[model samples]
Target: MEAFVSTEDEPDEVVDAELVPGDSHLPVIRHQTPLVPDADPDAWLPPEAAQDVADGIAQATRDAYELHFTQFAKWCAMEGRRHLPAAGDSVTAYVSHLTRTPREKTGKPYSPSTLDSVIAAIRTVHRDRKLPVPETKGARQVVTGYRERLALAKDAASRPNKASPAKRDVLRRAVRTLDRTTLAGRRDAALMLLGHACATRGGELVHLDIESLTPDDEGRGFTARLYRRKLKKWQDVGVFYDEDEELCPVRATYDLIDALELEGHTTGPLFLRMDRWGYLAPPMQREGKTIGDPTGRMTAEAASDIVERAMARAGQPGRWRSHSLRRGFVNSAREAGVDIVDIGRHGGWADGSKALIGYIEEADAFSDSNPLAQINEAERRKRGAHDQH
Candidate 1:
């Protein structure tokens, strides 16, 4: 198998390789070689086949894999151990190191999910290189042990970091605070309402275009055609007219459309970036021609920030994130007596999804079926009977 090579002049000695914010001194490793060296170039994959192989995974996943693999390589270089075709013991030791090490900025060790991703990244790189993936049973056991430790800790950081739901009340308050006349306000209003109505993820919200929306025959709502990445298909979600015009998703959509149409943008991205001065950023271009591009659309991070800012403005405290809309929809629907399966379908959750089931369980925690609720009701009835006697 090919050995990892550093880009630095001295191969034996590791250079500045700290992974810190604003630190550009991390060592780069040249890792493009095949896992097993071949004397004949014909042993390598054809260019087209290699391209297809590369395209198998999503770009975001590929980016993450590259980052995690690079970090692992740096650690190996620092420890004078082989990274590519790594030994099982080395993999276990690395997991332990990550579990114990805390980030300089956050002063917190990597979460279980992050540690899992690191192992996945290592496996992916090996698989991509046509190498046998290193044994991960020990590495997985280490992660499981860490998870058990966190569960025992029972602290805020140990608990799952769930996003606060933007329930109907919270959404209403947040939308009412927005200035409807301003471009940013109108965009945000539409973004939030439509996002909630469709139970959209941040990426889905930003990827929507004008062409994706179609009004219903009764003019009572709009059907948004969204491509579900997880399901790998297009699904239509209904955004109905609300009784309260102030919080109506349909009204918000039209208002934003009218505003954008007035600005000579009747197509392309449904949500766009706006400068502080209230000017919409123009569509991105390539070779003097406008193209459908991410640069012209709102980013997932920006969408989350907007939700966080809206919640702050409404004085609703808690950790609100982009996922709040989807979660809020599920919880609110469950409270309104909507069937669990229907809620899952509307929110694009696969049938019998454990995640959707978990949300339902949380929403039902204090409902009529709970023992505590039944006990409280019985106590109230007993007191009322005594008072009557």
Candidate 2:
């Protein structure tokens, strides 16, 4: 019989054992005291299964959870409370503390959405350890009350800091600042134009592969099969040529592709990193074959920085981020009289998304619902008739 290794550090006092068909000689030991009390014996996983469970979650999500849980643990240590199996009242008090406590950098209380994420993080960590997740009913109620209080106070700080939309005028000016002859310049131009045209999130933009792009049959534009991580599916986004060659997304994309081909890369990452000297980083290779590597690919943060730098160089003010391109597309499309449903589909927004609706509503406020515009038009018409008479 082979010795069974316990998953945890505690000594395993095996009271009984059983054998299965595949590994008849190896025993599945049953400990006198289980790690999770009242848990079903059949539901327990072996030590070997830990990595498989962790692999199910995305790396980015796991990183965030680790950070959130660490913060909760530190807070618990300060308050002299257990965090692993947190008490219901202790969870509620933590929620209150988070709501009232101002962040060191921002000097404002954490947003309601952030508070919700923290509570979710705590619940997730408890579940991962096979422990009964603490009831967050009180925590939820506390968050709801915080929202109500924010509404009543009407504090500007309570509002979300939405990224400013980079409309057509700003985009046109920004692209002009780049020197087309340089490889870096061409890549930056393509990145911004393509991002705006497809309304791509920063993550989606950075992950795009060269093979995913297909030139249109009529040579009008390109159709990119972008993988939406949230939807867990590939979505097609079409970007057409603009009348102005300087601002054409299709032209910019082609220029970038041509430059990359000169560097002997026909596939792999659609965007590559470049140094200050304008030298493109070579594709990563393993066993004499190109492979996907973080070193050769642009990060989401880098994409945001590119957008901000371009906007700053163009002298366009206000807070600009990568999301500005997506938001800008929705607002510009709505203003152009494009149907809301069509705009939502192009942007890969789930039906009935509040964020998409908010952009549409903002566009309508100035055009469709402006009472002052209606009054001014009526007065202008009456004055023209009297002048003619």
lDDT of each: 0.83, 0.82
Report the poorest 10 consecutive residues by lDDT, candidate 1: 1-10
Candidate 2 structure quality by residue, lDDT tens digits, 120-171: 8778877777667899999999998898788789965457778889888889
Encode model 1's per-residue lDDT on 12-70: one tens digit a residue. Answer: 65456776576568677667768656656565887788777777666667777777788
Candidate 1 pairs with clashing backbones: none
Q: Look at candidate 2 and tell me the lDDT of residue 163.
A: 81
Stretches > 4 Å off in candidate 2: 1-38, 45-58, 105-107, 148-156, 282-295, 369-389
**Collision count for each candidate, in order:** 0, 0
Best by lDDT: 1
Top-TM-score candidate index = 1
Model 2 weakest 10-residue run by lDDT: 1-10
